[model samples]
Target chain A: MDIDNISELIPQPVPLRDIDDSPGPCCMSFGFDLNPLIQSIEKVGLINPPLLKRDNQGSITIIIGYRRIKALKSLKADGAGCRILSGDDILPVECLLLNLYDNLAVRKLNDVEKGMVLARLIPWIKTLEIVEHYMPFLGLPSNRATLSSYLKIEEEMEVRVRESIACGQLSLRNAIMLLDIDSISRSSIIDLISNLKLTVNQQRQLIEYTVDLSHIQGRPIPDFLDDQSIKEINSDTRMNNPQKGRALIRYLRMKRYPSVSKAERKFKKMISRLNLGKTVKIDHSPSFESPYYRLEVLFKDGQSLREKLENFMREDIDSLRDPWKKKK
Target chain B: MDEGVQKYKSTKSILLQLKDIPVRAEKDDGPEEVACVSNELKRDMGKDTMHLVSYQGEFLKPCPGTKEYICCGYQILNVGTNCPLDCSYCILQTYFNRPNLRVHVNLEEQLGQVFQTIDSDPDKIFRVGTGEFTDSLALDPIIRWSETILRGFSERKNTVLELKTKTANTAGLLGSKYRDRIIVSWSLNSPFISCREEHGAVSLTRRLECARECQSEGFTIGFHFDPIIQHSNWMDEYRKTVDLMDKYIEPEGIIWMSLGSFRFMPALKPIIRRRHPETSILDGEFVLGLDGKMRYFKPIRMELYAFLNELLHQWHPDLGLYLCMESNEVWQESMGWRPETSEGLGNYLDERVRNFFG
Candidate 1:
C-alpha cells in the first residue's frame, strides 16, 4: 500500500451507523482490542486514516480500523467528544491487505491457526499459490505434509487430553504428545497419567518405557484397554498388596463403561464382607462442582486396617472366595 | 590499549566476550573489587544493564548425543550463555568455557535455525528450551531476545518454548499476545540460598511476585527445583518454599514444577573451589551416581522427595511435580509410583501443559 500526502486524506465519521452483525468476509478476529490503537491515536492522532466504504443505500461501512471505531464509541460513552478525523481518501486493496498483514505479522499465530489461515488464503488467488505465497507473506513454508501434520487430529488422544483437563490430571503439552504417540502405547500411558497423576518427567519416563516396551515386545504398542497382555495380567494377577490392589481396582473402575456409577456400592459391599468400617459416610459434589463421588470409611482406632488390606490382596493368593489361604 | 579492550574494563564487560575470548583480569589474578561488590550494587547495575557484545549464531540446536545412557533430552538455544550474577553454585561456571556472558543478538540467525528444525518435523512435538544453555530471560529487557523467540514460535503448534531463569526481568514479555505459546519459568530454591549462594539474584518473594504477575497476564508459569540442595533442616526449608509458592502463586497457572537433587560433575568441584572458595555446595554428603555426577545418596534423596511430595500434594494436589534425571526405583521408593518410561514424563507434562492451558 502506497501512502499519499498526509494533508489530502479526509476523515468522515458515521453517526449511529446500523451495521450487520454477521458481516460477510471480514478479516478481523472478533475479540480484537482497541486499547493499543487508542494509545496510538493518542500519540500520533490516527496515522492511517480509518477506511470506509459506502453501500448503494448510502450506508457507511467500516472497512478497517475496527479498533479505532470502538475506542471512539467508548470515548463518546464517557461524555468525551468522539474526535475522529474524517477521510474521503479511497483505500487501495493493498492498504486493506496491509491492515491484515500488520495484524497477522506482529501477533504470532500457532501452527494450526497458520494452517487454517493459509488454507483460507488459497482461494484468494489461484495463480500465486503454495509455499511461495506463504514464504513471501508470512515467512512460513507451505509444504503440504507439514500443513497436514499441524491439522491432523488424533481424536482418541484429544479426548484423553480433554478428560485430563476435566479431571484436573494432565497438561496440554503431555496431552498433545500422548496424541502423537503410537496407539499401542496410548493405553499404558493413559493409565499411568490418570492413576498416579505423575509429573511431566515421570510421564516422559512412562512414554520412554512404553517405547522400550514396543521395541522389546516385537509388537506395536498395545492400547491399554484392548491389549490382550494388559487384560490377562489384570484378570490373573492377584491384588496381593494394598497398593497393587488399589491400582488394579482403579484400572477396573476406569474400564467400567461410562464410569462405574455406584463407586460407593462396591465400597459398601466390601465393608460388609470384611467388617471394615464402624460408620460409613459418602460425599457427593453439586452437579457443577468437583469430586463427583467420594467414599470415606472410618475404621476403629486400633484396627490393623493396613495389614488386613495387604493380606487380602497378595498377588500369590489364588481365590478371593476364601480370604484365608496358605502355601502348601 | 585498544579502544575495544579499554571500553571493556570491568570483569562484567570482559565476561561478555566469553564465547570468543578467555576472560582474564588486567591484574593477572581477577577483578577483586568486581568480585567484592555487595549484592546490593549488583542489583543497581542490573537497571542500567550493560550489553557488552552481541554474536550472530544458531539459537536452538538439537542436544548433542552423549555416549552416557542417561541424558536430559533437551534441545539447547544458544541465546545467552552464563549469567552476570555471582551465584556461588551456578552451573554456568563449569557449563561454559569462560565467565563472560554472551547474548546472541543475531535473532534472525537464531530464528532461522529454530524455524528450520520445527518446520522439518511438524508431527513431532519438540521440547526445546533456552534455559538449558543460558538464562533465558536474563537479558530480556535490554535485548528482548525471549520476546523475539516467543514471537517466532507463537504460530507453531508443534513447539513449546520454555524461558527459564532466576531473574524477575520480564519487561520484555509484559503483554504478550501469544501468552499461551510460551512458558515463563523460574528456578526456585530455599530462602537460605536466595541470601547465600545466589548472590545478585532476586529474592524468593520477588521471584514468586514476578511469577504472580506473569500468571495474571495469562502466561503459563513453571517452577524448577533442579539441584534441590541437601542441608540441615532440608525438609523444613523445602516445605517452606512450597508453602510460600502455594501462597503467592496459583497452581493452575503453573505448567510444571521439577524436582532434582543437586548433582555436580567431578571436574566442577575444582572450579568452584578456585572461583567461589567460600561456597558450601560441595560440602554436603554426596556420592557418585551411575552418571558419574556427585549426588545425594538414594535415601537422602528419597527423604527429600517424600517430604516435598506430601507438602506439594497438601498445597495443590494437581500441581505437576516431576524429578529430574532420577531413576524409576527412586520414584517408586519416594512416591510409591514408577513411571513406565521417559516419555511418561514428557507425555504427562505435555498433557498437563496442554490440558491446563488448552
Candidate 2:
C-alpha cells in the first residue's frame, strides 16, 4: 500500500483523441476556460502528464487532469504524455482517490468539487469511514451530518444549482437549502443568489429570507423570486452587481417580513410627517434583527442644542408607539 | 376509532430487539434489528426502517426553551424520537439524521419513573406531555402507549398527561378504563394548513370528531393550534376550523387550548424545502427570533394569536388560552395578559388543573 507505488517515474505520449473524453461518473471537472491553462502549458510544457487508464477496447479514460487534456487539445497536441497505469489494473475508487490526492497536493478543491468527489466515494466506501478518513483531507468537517449533506447536494441538486456549485458561487450551507425547494424554484433561487454574487453570510441570509418567503406565501419560490420587482433588479442594466444584489435582497426582506417592513415604513413616514428640519436625523436598524434605534440632531451651540431639543420634544414620539406597536 | 387514525401503509415492518421480549419469540427477527440499531447503518437502501429499541437516556427533560422568550415550563416525555405523519414544517425532519420511527420501546416500562418524579413534586404541577418529540398516538396500534401512560397517570393529582396526536388512534385509550388525568389533545390548524401543509394527518373535522368521541367517554380533551402557518384568507379558514370545533366539541369538556405561531430552527428550513418541495409552510413571514429558531415577526405572531384568541374565546371564554414560547410583550399584546415567567405560566396552568381535575 505504498502511496508512491501507485505513481511511476515516467509518462507515455498518448494520442489526444485516443484519451477518451468521458472520464466516467467519478471525475470532478473544474470546467475552467482553458486559454489561461493553455498559456501556462505552452509557456512551461506539460507539468505532469494527465492520469489515465487503458480499458478493454484499448480506449483510455482520463483518471485525472481533464482540464489539462482540454488545454492540450486546444493546442492541437497529438499526444499527452500521460502517467498511464501499467495495465487496465486500477479500481475506479483508486483512480478517484489518486486524483483526490493530486487535487489536494496541487490544486485545492472547492467544497462543491469536494462534494462531487465525496458523492463518488460514498457509493463505494462506508459513510463513517468517509466521514472520518476522507473528509479531513478535503478540508470538510468530518462528520456524518456534513458528509451526508454534501452527498445530498451532489446527488439531488438541480443542474443550474450544480453549475453555481461547480463555479464556487454557492456555499454548501446555502446550496443545502436550495435542495428542499422544487426544481424550478431551486435553480431560480440559485440564479438570483449567484447573480448578486453575495458573500457566504449574505448568501445565507438571502436564502433564509427567500425560503421563508416561499413558505409563507405558499407560492412556488420561483414565482416570488420572479416577481416583476425582482426581475427588474435582475435585469437592471444601470445598477452594478452590488446594487442589484442589495436591491434583490431588499425586495425579499420586505416581502418576507411584510409587517416589520410596514411598521418601519410607517415609522419613517411619521418621522417625515414630523416636519423636522433637514438638520435633524433619524436612523433605524438596517433590518429588524435588532429593534435598537438611533436619533441624531446637529447643533452648533447651546442655543442650537436647546432649539433642537425643543423641536424634538414638540414632535409626537407617542405617535410612533401608538399604532405600529399597537395590535390592530 | 382506527378510521380517524390514518393507517400507516405497511411498507416496512417493525424491527424490534428487546431483552424483555418473550411474547413473540418465534419470529427471530431480533438479531438483525440489534445490528441496525447502531446508527452507523447509513442510508444504504434509500428507505428508513423503524427501530423500537429500549432507549437508554433520560426520558423526561424540561422542554428546551430560550430565556429571551417566556416558556410554559412544560416537561416532555421522550417516548420516541420521530413521527410517521409528515407535516411539511416538522423540525423532526432535520432534527435527527438517522431517520425512522425510533420508538423507545421501554417508555411503557419507564412510566413509573416519570410519574414518580411528578409524584415526588406534589406542590409543583408538572404539565407532562409525550408528543413533543414524537406523536403520542401515531403508533398506538403497534406501540399501545396510551394504555400504559393512562394507567400510570390515572390518579396522579399533581401531573396531567397530555397525549398530543394528529391521528384518531384512540382504540388503546378506548379500551383502557383509566382516564382521570389523561388529556387527549389534537394539534389543529387552519383548514388550508391542515389540508395543504400537514400531510398524512387526519382532517381538522376528523380530529374534532375524535375529540368529541374522547370527551364523550369521560376523558378531558385539549387542543393545540401549534404552527399556525400564515396564508391568504387564513382568518376564514381558521374560523371554519373553530366553527367545526364548536360543532363537534363541547367547550366545557376541554381543559386547555394552546395557540402557537409557526416556528422552526433555521437548519430545518432547507430540510423542509427538500423533504416537501410542494410545501408553502416555509413561505410564511419569519424572523430569526431571540432563539435561533425562525419565528413569525412579532406583530405577525400577535395578529395570528390575537385572531385565534378572539375566535376561541367567542367559542368559550374559559378555554384556558395560553401562548407557547413567546416574549412577555407578545403575551400581553396577544392574549391580553402576561404569565411573566415559566413558573408563572406553570402556576396559571396549575390553576386550570385544580379547577378541572382537583
Predicted candidate 1 versus true structure: per-residue lDDT over B1-358, tens digit per residue: 1123333223233355344644332322222233233334433333233333334345667655333222335567776666766677666666432234554445444476678888998776766788875677776654566445677666777777888888989877885577756888999888776677887778888899999999898888889987788765767787778888977999977878888878778666555655654556665545556666767655567777777778787888877888777777577767677665666666777677567545
The worst-scoring run of ten residues by lDDT in candidate 1 chain A lies at A318-327
Write down the TM-score of every candidate.
0.45, 0.82
Error of 2 at A175 (Å): 3.5
- For model 2, what is the alpha-carbon lDDT of residue A192? 70
Off by over 4 Å in 1: A1-328, B1-58, B62-72
* Model 2 Cα lDDT, one tens digit per residue, B1-358: 1121112222112323222433221222222321133334321211244554556688888999878787888889898877878788777766444455666766655777887788788888878898998899988887667656776677777888899999988888988998888899999999898888887899888888888999999999999999887888999999999999989999998888888888988767655655666777766667778778788877788889999999999989999999998878788878899988977888888899889899
Candidate 2: RMSD over Cα atoms?
A: 6.3
**Alpha-carbon lDDT, every model:** 0.57, 0.76
Clashing pairs in 2: A180-B273, A180-B274, A214-B283, A215-B282, A215-B283, A215-B284, A216-B282, A216-B283, A216-B284
Report per-candidate DockQ. 0.01, 0.31
Q: Give the DockQ (C-alpha) for candidate 2.
A: 0.31
Tens-digit lDDT string for candidate 1 (A198-235): 66655654554454334333446554334664455445
Query: For candidate 1 chain B, which ten residues in a row score worst on lDDT?
Result: B27-36
Q: Distance from true position, residue B206, model 2, in Å?
A: 3.7
